[model samples]
Target: MSKVFRSLLLITALSSVSQWAQAGNYWKATAKDGWLDGYVEATLLLNGNLDATSIDTDVDNGVVTLRGKVETDTDKALVQELVLGVDGVNGIENMLTVFSPGENEDSAIQRKLTDKKVATVVKTRLLVAPDIGSTKIDVNSSQGVVVLEGQVKNDAEKQRAVEIAKKITDVEQVVNKLTVSD
Candidate 1:
């Protein structure tokens, strides 16, 4: 090969290597975000004061986003503090809203009943679906929001569960926390 061709080939090889290195870094950052999400979830599950089902966490590029409702302001603060303890979490955006205290007893009861009904309907749909094994899944609903927590065999099962829940009437949102088994 001529000198010019040899130098051009060397430059092309270096460019390819640089691209691969950048891709690897991107993958590592993504994996770190996933790990942080899992850590926050597990911590919430273990906490006695915070209801894990009522809180959802998402992490992207090390920034954590907390969404959902809590019963009290103290619970909201507690969740924020607990999430800050997780390593690799660059920051937390706490979007948790406290349940309003102005509601009367009758309204609260009605809302509870409606939520229960929604949960029951979602569960029934999941049980009847041909692809989903409803035995391993748990469903909860509050204020038209459905929360699904359980382990499934694969990604297909997880997506099926979420779709089933979303199909239920009165279900305003579906928070899927389903895990795939190894």
Candidate 2:
């Protein structure tokens, strides 16, 4: 997306929160008002630029959660700094794991596959229709909480992603941080 367009959308999303702040269900209204797009853009840019081995971004209800895998614990601090600058990002939770050298590769693979199973369940339930923008959706799992990030065509798809994420077994929670394109 063009930088100007993205900036404008983010601004609009943030402003919507203010417009609806007086309404009951303040946070829900804030989230529903459309700030997630800019938040995701901010997170993507931050994570993409970070030096970590792997980083995933998930934004839900204006809160951004990060799932990362790094070779060193220091990568966490560096990543936090990067994520803090994004607009409309009300909060962040770190769910990164550090793997030491000589760790059992087989066990790691098994663990990853297990996580992938959770991811697959989310994908199957949420993205069953090929017409949905599944390609844009990114799913990553760590300790069974499914993280969703992507741009959907509308609120229905966004809601669908969340519902499907909720369906994934063993997941403690579903972080549906999908942004809808205008």
Candidate 3:
């Protein structure tokens, strides 16, 4: 009976220690995430190209979520790029929308904005696609036409890139100038 009581106490102590260790880890992760959030916000504020006033940033376990509107798609992509450069940023969920107030959709300015948005979207999709070397590809858009240029690892990759660009809304045509690499 005495030995059984001692064993029970030992087990309870071990369980308590395990719980404390887990709680400590949680607090450490939370603190790290908070630090990363501040760093990301400061980085955005310091960038001249970004209007950080309209942006909202949140960080969780090293992942950052950006919610807001930007003047152009270039600005949206730029935000993600800048945040990704921050130390400890594991990933990003970019929810930025391109918006220009008081502009008519049919107007030339609006058309240019749409074109830029299409280009940015295509470039981002290519960058995220599996097995695609997006760094080697240059994406451009003008008047609803998208041009893909650069070297691809194989013909299949070239075809995949063209298909991805073509599927994007507002992309009326996809001109593939991708060379198959040796």
Report the number of the highest-lDDT candidate.
3
- CA lDDT of every candidate: 0.79, 0.62, 0.82
Global CA lDDT computed for model 1? 0.79
Q: Write the per-residue lDDT of candidate 2 for residues 1-182, one digit (tens) a residue.
A: 59999999999999898787756577675565346645444444534324543667667676667786755443454455445434455777878676642244466664565575566545544544444665678888887678889888888888877776675455787787789877
Q: Can you give the TM-score per candidate against the true fold?
A: 0.52, 0.37, 0.58
Question: Of models 1 and 2, which has the larger lDDT?
Answer: 1
Could you tell which candidate, 2 or 3, scores higher by TM-score? Answer: 3
Highest TM-score, which number?
Answer: 3
Q: Any residue pairs clashing in model 1, and if so which?
A: none
Cα lDDT of model 1 by residue, 1-182, tens digit: 69999999999999999999999999998888888889889877876545779899999988899999987554565677667656677899999987853243477775675676567656655765688764789999999899999899899999989987886666799999999988
Candidate 1 wrongly placed segments (more than 4 Å): 101-182
**CA-RMSD of model 1:** 13.4
Give the per-residue Cα lDDT of candidate 3 at 74.
54
- Model 2, position 111, has a per-residue lDDT of 58
